[model samples]
Target: MNSTVTMIVRLLLAIILLVFGANKFFNFIPMEAPPEGSFMDALIKTGYMMPLIAVSEIIPGFLLLINKWKGLALVWLAPISINIVLFHIAFDISTIAPAALVFTLNTFLIYINWKKFRTLF
Candidate 1:
């Protein structure tokens, strides 16, 4: 893709990540309580792990926005995507669509930045 298109995609992804991450930290978006006995409920039950997850999301979101650490951001973001996908899948497929989309986007980003990723190996 052209630099312009790449830049736009990157910006869009960064904005989405940052917003979602901040929501995790601040609950800026109202979230319905997960159903009892749900996977999300299990996640919530993990003391302190929630904030760490929030930080993981927020940190990479900020880094992606800066655009200088695209590779590093993707490295951080990949597992996040995986976790999200798994969480959603384990919980309910419908609830996981967003995570799937984000995962797909991350996969594309990784593919697009393959050169940078390859150099690290």
Candidate 2:
């Protein structure tokens, strides 16, 4: 990838993650509640799960912003992105657009970092 493009994408994704993840804790970005009986509603009802999930988002978002251990940060965010995609697909179709964006960014990052990952497989 072009270095400039890489940096732009990295910064955009990092900013997005940082804002959303921080919102999870701060509730600064008001969002509608997930539908009743939906998976998200159930998860939210659990009390403990949301905080952990929020932390997971914050950590990777911070790492990505710093451009440190970005590959590892993307690796950490992978499952979270997948879950976001799946959850939106299954429960809230209206939200899949952002989830798709998240998935795509993570995928693109991983592709560009293929050299770093080649030995893992």
Q: Which lDDT tens digits does candidate 2 get at residues 41-70?
A: 888899978888888888898898899999
Per-residue accuracy of model 1 over 43-78 as CA lDDT, tens digit each: 889877778887888788788788878888889899
Global CA lDDT of candidate 2, please? Answer: 0.87
What TM-score would every model get versus the actual structure?
0.88, 0.93
Weakest 10 consecutive residues, lDDT, candidate 1? 4-13
**C-alpha positional error of residue 68 in candidate 1 after TM-score superposition, expressed in Å:** 1.8
Candidate lDDT (C-alpha), each:
0.82, 0.87
- TM-score attained by model 2: 0.93
